[model samples]
Target: MDIVNALALFANFVAVPATAYGAQLALGALGVTLIFGILRFANFSHGELMSFGAMATILVTWTLQDLGIGIAPFPTALLALPVGILASIAVSLATNRMVFRFYQRRRANPIVFAIVSVGVMFVMAGLIRIIIGPDDQSFADGERFLITAFEFQKATGLKEGIAIKQTQVITVVVALVVVAALFWFLRKTRAGKAMRAFSDEEDLALLSGVNPDRVVQIAWIITATLACIAGTLYGLDKTYKPFIFLQILLPIFAATIVGGIGQPVGAILGGFVIAYSEVMVTYAFKKVITYLSPTDWAPEGLVQLLSTDYKFAVSFIILVAVLLIRPTGIIRGKVI
Candidate 1:
């Protein structure tokens, strides 16, 4: 129970992995929130969209690797991100035109739209599994760890070494840039303002000469881009599998719900909150606590709060709690 040691251990647990995971969840939640705001429905298919984008990036990266082209200090998948984004955009737009567009034309209820999205999710899930054969694929190569623990220890001459992966650093930086750009666009740009207008009041926006179809198209494109970025980063940091995307759905939804389904800022905050909670709750703090704690005060039992297998359950519990406490979300997201 040495306070200094306990604080340091907590910091380590909270800082690195939480940051990387928060960025990933934020990116995924951004897409979900945008769809909820603009399209006015919960997109259950978003996780599958992420999987599709990650798979596309993996394919492109492999192709580039075969050609002997790569980013030396970074993963080749980083270089192939744009291709993956474009492919995801195409898929999202095509889905809108073929499946959701019919429902839109008929002015379907929000509940019906939600149901349709679930159907779309199943279809996309099946498509990804068919293409990838439901196998795990590692898409990371090149620089593995950005700063090795030993290197940091050598440089700082501190007993505590901090290891940062190149992919992890990239994930944080890229997510920041993307989120900043999105906020700037939403707040300042003409097209971005138009999108906000549509989300705020579709009828009024239409009367204001905003093109509905164009706004919807742009929303889908932006969502696709965010999905591509998030999915690729997640794949790089962890491993890519069609099934993992489905598993990520709970965290993404948790973020969106906890933040307020249609609120952008809420989504970002919710992502980090969920990520840190899940990581902290499940992480075995034995090594970290031992490093900092005095021998006499250290607990006999492992300091983990929950098993890693229950990560999804943690997210679901948070989602439900948020729903009961503030159904509109912390940001007062529109219920409609």
Candidate 2:
């Protein structure tokens, strides 16, 4: 029973939430990695891009709810997700046309592009706050949980049982599907092949008649699509707040770098690693330990390695460590 309770506590505090968070981070990091591999610049504006998408989804979902539309057991935001994706695509295209294209034409240095993206980041970040405000918005609707804690314990007739949220399951499932589709698109499509060729050898790709503009357009579209999906999932799992997306930028970047800056597999791998570390390090294991310990033998301390207030600090520490210790990332130099 003690062992079971200990396992349940671990599942409740660390496994479930971290997995959902990791899935969200992985999707965001994938977009970042894709941009790094293909477009060759750190897209500092992606956080705002994500915020914009979530805002779009939330607004549309509200409108739909007001109109008496809902999916009952699942969130209506799922249905409204495409609207957010479309809005994000529009923003991405407009940004690329009005901003990034000039730099691309000039063949500017990557750092120059990075600086420009920083400026765009501020503008977009401000625009999202103006549209959505800086307050937390609850956009979730329908059934909130696949199983409640008490229900799970009752059903299992156990001292401890793990509860799983509907959003968490949905997030993981959606992320898996999206990743699979993306991998398929990249591996088996002509356009994806062209993009890969461009990323691999730009001069040769141009010589091979791959249109640069087409590639750029596709990259922006995919990045925006990814941003929307990730943002919407995150908002549904947590809550929608403009500023939170800005903070999320740190973990997404940390994941991308830890997985390997230009590697998709690395990005996904890095997200889970960072998420688990954050959760495990910050979580208090006192109750679980008490359950597992003999009578009056439990430790007195909280059994937490770090306070939850410093969760994001874990990502920062990991990011700095990775930069100093393994600049090539955990996966070595796999570019894409």
Candidate 3:
């Protein structure tokens, strides 16, 4: 009974939150990886793209709320997600048209494109901040917790209880749906085949009659949808802040690199690994130990491996290690 309770405590504090966070990170990383694989350059502006979509969603959600519209059990943000995605797609397309196309026409190097993306990142980030300000934007309506601690305790008749947030559940469900749809599209659709063929060999694909422009356009659209969904879900889980989105770029990049930068499945795996590592290391195990051990045997220390403030550093360290150990990544993605 004590062991079970201890595990329950761990699940309540660490597992559930980490899973939701990992799913969100994976979705965000997928956008980054897709762009890198298909577009042949790292778009540093991805974080800003997320911010743009999330800000758009927030604006629309506010408008809907003002009109007394809501989804009740689910967040009204769900309904506004499509609007956010479309806004992101427009921004992506416009940038590709005005800026990326110039580089494409010039046949610039990948590093050049990367440097250009950094400039675009700054411009886009500034625009978002100017438009939305650098404050927390909170607009969520519906159930708060799908399973409360007290309810879990009552149901299980255990000393320790688990609490799962509604947002967390929604995040997992939505991520699974999105991932499934992406896999189906990529595996079964004609355009997806063209994109894959292009990624495999540009010259061969070109000779085989694949349209580079169409492939790039489709990639941007998919990347935009993924970014927008990830951004909105993250904001719903936490809060919408322009600066926070920028910070998220670190973990997202880490996830992408660790999981094999160009591999979709690797991104998902890396996300969970990084998330669980962060949560487990930072979470103080004192309570769980106390529940498990005899009263007198309980430890005095918090038993946390690291402070929560150092959580982001975990991703950096892991990323460096992966780069050093296997440049090709765990699942054999693009070698960096």
Model 2 C-alpha lDDT per residue in residues 53-99, reported as the tens digit of each score: 88898899999999999888999999899999999999999999999
Q: Residue 157 error for model 2, in Å?
A: 1.5
lDDT of 3 by residue, 1-336 (tens): 278989999999899999999999999999988888877787789998988999999999999989989889889999899999999999999999888888876768889999999988999988998998989989888999999999999999998889999999999999999999998988999999998888878889999999988898999999999999999999999888888887999989999999998889989988888889888989999988888786648778999989999999999898999999998778899874
The better candidate by lDDT, 1 or 3, is 3
Residue pairs with clashing backbones, model 1: none
Clashing pairs in 2: 259-266
Candidates by TM-score, descending order: 3, 2, 1
Provide the global lDDT of candidate 2 against the true structure. 0.90
Query: Candidate 1 on 151-184: residue-level lDDT in tens?
Result: 8768866666677888889999999999999999
The TM-scores, one per candidate, come to 0.94, 0.96, 0.97
Off by over 4 Å in 2: 294-296, 334-336
Q: Which candidate achieves the best TM-score against the true structure?
A: 3
Task: Tell me the alpha-carbon RMSD of every candidate.
Answer: 1.9, 1.6, 1.3
TM-score of 2: 0.96
